[model samples]
Each structure stands twice: as structure tokens, then as C-alpha cells.
Target: MTNSAPDVPATPEQLRRSIADRTWTSPTAGILDGYQQANLVVVPASAATEFAEYCRANPSVCPLLASSAPGDPQLTYDGCIVDVRTMVPRYRVWQNGRLAEEPFDLTPRWREDSVAFALGCSHTLDGPLRRAGIPVAVTAPPVYITSLTTRGTTRFDGAVAVSMRPVEDDLVDTAIAVTAMLPTGHGAPVHIGDPAEIGLADLASPDFGVFPGIGPNQTPVFWNCGVTPQLALAEAGLEYAATHYPGHMLVLDTVVAA
Candidate 1:
């Protein structure tokens, strides 16, 4: 909800701690510059395997980072420890495929049968893109459910979700090349130019996140969004589930190679 930048800690651990303490609750788009940010998907142990398979079938949008053992709240990757219960700034709790609540922490909702999966987030590339002289939005970009359907699993099937960024015509290739180096950030764009080609009719109104407004001479570039799993989760009608609210990622100590 809030787009204004809050004073953030210098390290990822500190950032996580701050988030846990409720000191920071804004979206993680442009903050914490180089550290990797992860999209979260916590499901029951019964659906974990199928969900993991779903991620594998759609790597572009769900580049699996790390998963936690059932009933465990922690996920470790490259020496970084992330507590799924409290580290993320916000969480979306789903019940039977319907979004039940948007909570600041998952502590109360964490269950004995819960399994958490971390997916690569496009926010990880924001710092690199900005450093490359490309103007990046401070808040999360608009996300739309496209006509493109992801390769699905028995329990998970849905249309692909993409986040759109407006890039100057000249910087389009530079933006692509810069992001391509980091697969962990949903590397490169999935679509460019016309939004209708991707089933996006109106850029002004998005299915998720606020539209950042495309300017003249700037082309709309779309990337496979980490939010894709939420669509699957909705379609699956799972009894219980949790995910990072769009753009509110778990900051990881590991930096993506750019």
C-alpha cells in the first residue's frame, strides 16, 4: 500500500529482522539493492510435491530457490537463513483457493503440515537495471494474467501472470541483456511491444499491483512474474496456503550473479 521508501538496514539479515519486527512493511522493489529477493509459497505437505513439480514445469516464472521441510518455518540458501513465518513484509493467506487475509506475519497461520517454497523474484534485477541507466519503478509494476497458460500439474493450472515495465525504445535491448544475465531474477523479458499480444488490453488497469504509467517512446516490457503460483493456488482450491503479497519479498543474503 505504501510506496514511499523507508529507511532500510544495510544488510539482508538486518532487513529481515526489521521486517520481522514490523519496522518495515513497504514493498521490496527498489530497496535492499543487490540482495536477492524471493517469492514465497507455503502449502500443506500433501500438495508440496505437486507444487514443486508445477514450479519445475514453469521455471521461467517459478525458478525454485529453496524449500523448507514440512512444519519448518526456516529456509536456508547459501548461508542465508529466512524465516517464512515472519521475515516477509506481508503475506497473503489463502483458504480453499480464496484469498482469506493479507497479514503482516504468518506466525499465527503457520501449521504443522506447512511447507514453504521460495521462488526467484524479478525485484532482484531492479538494482542492476537501474545501475545500467534504465529507469526502474520504485514500486511494483502492474501485473496481468495473460492468455498464455503455464505448463501445469494435476493440482495446479492457470494463465501466466506478467509484470510490465516501461522502457525507452533505445534501452529495450540493454534492459534485456542486463536482466538476461540473472536467471534467478526471472531473466530477460517474456514479451515486448504490444500488450494485446499477451492478452493485456489496458495497461492503465492491471490485475495486480499499481500501473506505473507508460510514457511516450517507452515500450512496455513484460516478465514472467513470481505471482504465477498464486493463480495456480487459487485454481487448485487448496484448503490452506500462504504467499508473499505481490512485491513484498523475502530478502536473501545471496546476491544474484549479474
Candidate 2:
């Protein structure tokens, strides 16, 4: 489905209110420019510690942002209160590690033992990339499950997921440098040039998100994506879990420096 631009509010809190009210449910890219965006993961209290450890083990793919105590619907970062069940535009419900449904509000499925986690999203780097004169794709970029595996904890172990963006051949270095400074945004490109080296045979067909074709002078650069946790959740095969839909992230009030 194509995403249409909505009337964006001036602040992250306002945008979040719109999202909670179902006024804005599209992929949040290029909106709320300087604010940090985050990927969401809600799991049962039983698996929360293991999942948290798994994220810490692989910082590039899952940069830990903030986590909520079990049964707590809210996550706070930068003194901003984020209601995990309502703040996100859309959520993917997982049953037995499989995607069961995509829901706008997670309230119906919220469990008393549920624990929510927020991870750094690469979307936070969009402003810096644009300021560096790099072209960022208007649509969500393609994400692939790589052959490379992540350092896993007891319950979470699986291949890493990487998001691809076509960068001008000349600005590849700048892209890396610009993103590296923002550790909260998944940092820098993990792979560059060949997708096959990472087991992506067809660049045209990605495992997730849309594939914006590469330009003649552009090179495909891959970054460790927040979606990595989703793959791990599937691998763990938990009875129930939840995550933000790919590209639809939780907009945070935390202001990031470009």
C-alpha cells in the first residue's frame, strides 16, 4: 500500500497525539525532522530479559533506547512519556513468532505481563543525511534478511536484517561518517557494494519494505536495521509478542543534533 503524506504537527508530542487518535497512520519518514524515532518490541515478561540481552549483544542492529517494566504501558526517554500501546502508528502482532495481525492500536492485545522496548531507528539519521547533501529515498527503503547471523542470547538468535539505501558513489564516505556520529540511529553502513556477499541475490526483491531502484551513479549501502529484532522474535517463537510495523516507527520527543 502506498503511504500518503499527512498534515504533520510541529512537535513530536503533537504528532504522537495525532497517531494515537488515528489521525496519522502512515510510515513516519521525513516528518518531525530533528526528533528521534524508535522501533518498538513488546514481549512477555518471561522473555524480556533475554530479549534485552540479545539487543545489547548486537548493538549495531538493535541499539537499545528505552524499555518499560512489565505491565507498564509507558516508556520514558528525555522525560517524554510514550504509551507503547497507543503511540505507534501501527503494530504487528506476533503469535508463536509469526506475524498474526497488523493493528493500529495495541490496547486490545496488551497483556499484564507485557514488556515494551524501544530501539534506535535509522530514520533518525534522515535529517543529517539530507544536511550532508545526500539523497534520501522518499519511500521506505528495502530491507533484507542477511546470511550474516547476530550474536544471540539464549532465546533470541537469527540472521540480521539490513535496510538498503542507494547512495551516490561519491558520497558513500560522507553517508557513513554522517550516520556513524549518531549511535542511536543504528550508526553506519554495515555492508556496501555487493548484496550477494550478504546473501541478497535479487536487489529488486527485498525481504521487507520497498526497493527504490538504484541510480546509475549510486551504490547500495546497507545499515543494520531495527527490523533485526522482529526476525529474532520470529526465531524465538514466543507465544505472543508485538512490534512496530516496518517503517512505521514511534516518533519521540527527544531532539537529536544533526
Candidate 3:
């Protein structure tokens, strides 16, 4: 059974509309349940092949979803016509290794050779956990950073950053069982102990989002997050690329075709 939270709408149309209009540019993690969410990377076609190769070499971290052919904003192969320019809640456009706040659209800087890539995301795991009666704690969406360094595919290099969730110790096993079946969702826990073990010096200070302390005896489990790709982008110093603002995913009807 899937989770049936009252606030989780039967359809994500409302949420998607809000995002497209730029009215709701916040995180989309908990707004919709069961739907697949993806991280995005839109870059020039000059880098698409190498990036595709990189994705192939590193499937656990950067699981690819859909991609539009060159110059196409329509991700139609998956029948999900995301407006690459505005469908996402927010965009992070980078130039020559520096990061900017958020770009509502990439019209001005849209590369003629640009292509987009979607990666599988961790939010896909939360639904089943909630249904299983596992207590998955979150102030909103758990934006987290992993302490492990991803095996970089060339210029991409950085520690994997993951969202944190406080799982009750007893439900940890069930949560693992539930998530393992979703192979595209980074599989299962990458680490399950003190944040310090993953080089996370403290739980209070995450690379993103608010961090509430782990409850008494609750365990901190980590996963091979999709944000791994964004970190890789940041590390590579790619002159032109855009990623969805962390936690602000593309809630698509398309499942992870991986």
C-alpha cells in the first residue's frame, strides 16, 4: 500500500502549475506522494556525450532518466513535456565555476547546443516508508549532504550530498526492505550511523536545508543521493549548466525508466 497522507494530493497538477508559474519555488519533496521525482542538468550538447558517458560510468550516483534531443525543450520520448526552461520549481545556472541564486528561465543564456538530462531522485523512497508505518521524520523535505566522495568521472569531483531523515531504529530494517525494491532510488542505505562517520562533522549544519537533531536512539541512514550529480557539476566547474534548486524536483508522471 502507498501512503495516503491527507495533504498529498491525488494529482500533482496543482503543485506543477505552482512551480511552472514560479509562484511556488520552494522544495517539492513532500507535496506529492508515489510520483517519481528527478534532478535535472541542462547543458550544451558539446558536453552531453561525455556527461552521458559519465552517467553510464556512475549509475549509482547519477542515474539518468529522460533527455531531450538537441535544441528540444520537449522531453517527449518519456511523454513528459517539461518546459526545460520553466517547468522546474527553480533553476541553478552556473557560469565558469561560480553559482548564482536561481534562474526562472534560461532564455537569455540558453545554449544553442543545449541538452537536458534527468536523474533519479531519493524522494521516491519516502512514500513506501510512510505507508509501512515507519516514522520518517522531516521538518519539510530533508535536504542532506553525504560525507562520501563520489568516484568522479573526469573533472567531476566532490563528496556526495544527501538529504537526511530520522528513521526509528525498529523500522530501519523495513525501510531498507521497502527501498531496496526500488532499485532506481539509489537502492538502499549508503551509511547508517553517526553523521561524523560520513565526514559530516555535525548534523546541525547541513550543506542544505534545516537539520533537526536525531531523536533519542534514532539512527541516521544515508543513501547514494542523486544530488551527487549536482555536486559533480559544481566540482567540474562546467561553464554553463543548470540544475533544479535542491529539493525542488521535477514531479513527473514518468517513472524512472532506468
RMSD per candidate (Å) reads 1.7, 1.6, 4.7
RMSD from true fold, candidate 3:
4.7
lDDT of 1 at 196: 91
Query: Which residues of candidate 2, in runs, are more than 4 Å off?
Result: 1-5
The candidate maximizing TM-score is 2
Evaluate all candidate structures by whole-model CA lDDT and list the values in order: 0.90, 0.90, 0.71
Task: Give per-residue CA lDDT, model 2, range 1-258, as digits (tens).
Answer: 334547788999988998888888898878876889999999999999998899889988898989999999999987999899999999999999778999999999999999999999999988889889998966677889899999976789889888888999999999999999998999988999999999999999999877899999999999988888888899897999999998899999888886
TM-score of 3: 0.87
Q: In angstroms, how far off is 241's CA in candidate 2?
A: 0.3
- Model 1, 141-243: lDDT tens digits are 8899999998876679899999889999999999999999988889999999999998888989999888888888999999999888999999897999999
Candidate 1 TM-score, true structure as reference: 0.96
The CA lDDT at 12 in model 3 is: 62
TM-score of 2: 0.96
- Summarize candidate 3's per-residue lDDT along 65-176 as a digit string, tens digits: 7787888876642566677677677788887667865766556656777898888778877776787897654334444665577666667667777767778888888877
**lDDT, candidate 1, at 106:** 96
